[model samples]
Target: MNPSITGFDYQRVTVAEDVALNVAVGGSGSPIVLLHGFPQTHLMWRHVAADLAADHTVICPDLRGYGASDKPAGTVPDAYAKRTMAADIVALARELGHDRFALAGHDRGALVAIRAGLDHPGAVTHLASLDVLPTLDMWDVLHGVTAAVGFHLFLMAQPPGLPEELIGAAPDAFFGHFLDIWTRDPEAIPAEVRAAYLRACREAVPSIVADYRASAGVDVAHDRADRAAGNQLRMPVTVLQQDWGAALGFDAAGIWRAWAPDLEHRTVSCGHFMAEEAPAETVKALRDLLAR
Candidate 1:
């Protein structure tokens, strides 16, 4: 049996013509969709979801091509594009009876949330992102030695064959590497939870690689177009990050301000997986965002 969010009702919500997302939904009164990051699943939001469920209907879904969700082969060129994935989330929420909802995402999930806010501004009431810059800003800022921290992005960005084969060869070490290094406190991710993440990622190697590959290609193009058109997130936005901008030599909040006019950006002391390592703070930040 796989690990899941306790007390949450689980179901498969068909979000596309062929893709149905495995979703865990709980609580009532208004909806807030939570999207998980790479190398993990909706279970990553177990702590925060439960806390938020007290007042808000919490919807956590394993994004398409991840976890228990359907992973249609990336036969279409834009199959794994953030725009497409964002549409999946929108459709999922509507299927679950939400026409509008607040949105929050971490890491890769944050990227998808950004796309959703831009593409469907009418649907997202508020937005929050944890630990990631927009795709275009991400590519622009990562250069020379600083880019080494995101080597996997470059590796997975390769043209299809080698990246998939190499990563598939030793999926655990490849997937577990982030699980080990990116986490500040090991205990934040319990043994069982870590194992589940590794298992899910191991099985979804090709699709996972395609996801990152799209970030490097189509995702960037989408963000670039949005920037050119001066498209910005109209909804109120909150961003929580680990002060990577200080080390990486960029103004994190400044960059975010360009895309989100009504923005609240704060730097946290915790690691990349802040929701697990610092759920209380994460929850408080979320609650505050909701109040606004």
Candidate 2:
């Protein structure tokens, strides 16, 4: 039930001793790694990856704990930290013979891309982030009543047992909720692809929760350290968001500016799932960022 992204060859590459990533690679020329977000697989980038593959070598991988990737159920909160996830991406690209490449991430993947750009400046030529704020800013923005929009964040942030138990109780309903609400058009994601996402998520519950759990714990600590050290993305960065700041009363661009000195922050008129909801615009934004 993979997305209808033809012409790409899939492979399982070991990025770490205990972890391997399921990757989809296509096309030629300079490489660009595309990372998918929550409740979805690399299939989420079918369209954008396909388009980018026409010119660049598009490397799309299911971030470590999601999709068909290796999901080690470690109790440590740092298990799924962006730093670890970001290292996974870098290792995957290097395994595929890409020492340096342009990187774009959507949702949770965007968080990873931000970390990659910051942590591996010389290795990432360009960086693009869609529909997400940095980890520290994300937690800060979710303070008080505005946090209601991301109840899943709070739920997943809790200690292991309950969240996993509750989500696993009705895996389809839990994952489908985000898929249904996050997209602007219900029909944007084909029913079969939706089914695939649900199936994968259902099978990867523990790994998935661990991924979110790391955000509240280790991810925040890493962000705070980076912030204190004044470590911003050294590459040209482009951030495309749904203008949540307007509704939530936080300055999205201003927040991102603190983490990325050379940044182009713009708002997209789409839902949280920008790549699927607005592929053309998403592709254009990535192209602009790559050219930088």
Candidate 3:
């Protein structure tokens, strides 16, 4: 099938020996980096990137373990930690001639953006995270039957061998479950896009598992250290989510307030794939963040 973003240039930039990200670059103005979530790639930014290109230089990259990026060996634990992934993003922006940029990420990418904001506050002028609580808050909020909604988190959090092996056996079904359930608009994700996601995920099963493994262990530890240090995101921050707080009986804004001092947290009536399902709203929210 034809590509998602027409006329966009693609490059594989090396971040580390075993890591290089496939990046799509378009437009020509203040740089804005859009990171995709799990089981997907830079293609997720198709609608938003094209629109943003009218006013901003849009950089959409497949993160370290997904899409066309390097899926390094999973033997070493914590290799896929968000801290490490965030560093890759920083290096990516530097390679693209942008030392600092506005950043937005969804799902797994949101976690990476969160870490990036905390670890390299100077590099991110404005930060936006869609559909996630901070790592510690995520674990804290999740309990009882509500936690069942995040069965995948617990499954992937297990030790290296089992998670990877079980997922590898039926990678498509395992990953496709999220794509099917999380989005409200079943038609928002085209058949071609769905196939592409499954294909990328199936091929990168080991690295994908390693990525989630880091979240349960190293990513959480990194978040804790940041909390202990009382370091908050220095840049302007905006969060758009599906109001999991209302459903789970916790104040989403309250939890985010602890991390983002300069905050604009709001709930959007959209699916997890807001960028694809509601691009205009997503872009409007992001434009507001950029203006901030």
Which pairs of residues collide in candidate 3?
none
Per-residue lDDT of candidate 1, residues 1-292 (tens digit)? 7888999999998999888999999999889999999788999999999999998999999999999999989766689999999999999999998999999999989999999999999999999999999999998999999999999999999997999899989999999999888998999999999999999998898899999999989998899899899999999999999978999999999999999999999899988999999999999998999889
Candidate 3 residue-pair clash tally: 0
Off by over 4 Å in 3: none
Off by over 4 Å in 1: none
TM-scores of the candidates in the order shown: 0.99, 0.98, 0.98
The number of clashing residue pairs in model 2 is 0
- Top of the candidates by TM-score: 1
lDDT of 1: 0.93
* lDDT for each residue of candidate 2 in 1-292, tens digit (9 for 90 to 100): 4664689998999998889899999999999999999989999999898898889999999998898999987577677889999999999999999899999998999999988988899999999998899988988888788889999999998887999999999999999999988888988889899999999999999989998889898989989999999888989999999878999998999988888889999899988888988999999999988888
**Model 3 agreement with the true structure over 147-220: per-residue lDDT tens digits:** 99999889988977788898899888998999989989999999989998898898888888888888888888
Indicate the worst ten consecutive residues by lDDT in candidate 1: 70-79
Q: After superposition, how far is residue 160 of candidate 1 from its true place, in Å?
A: 0.9
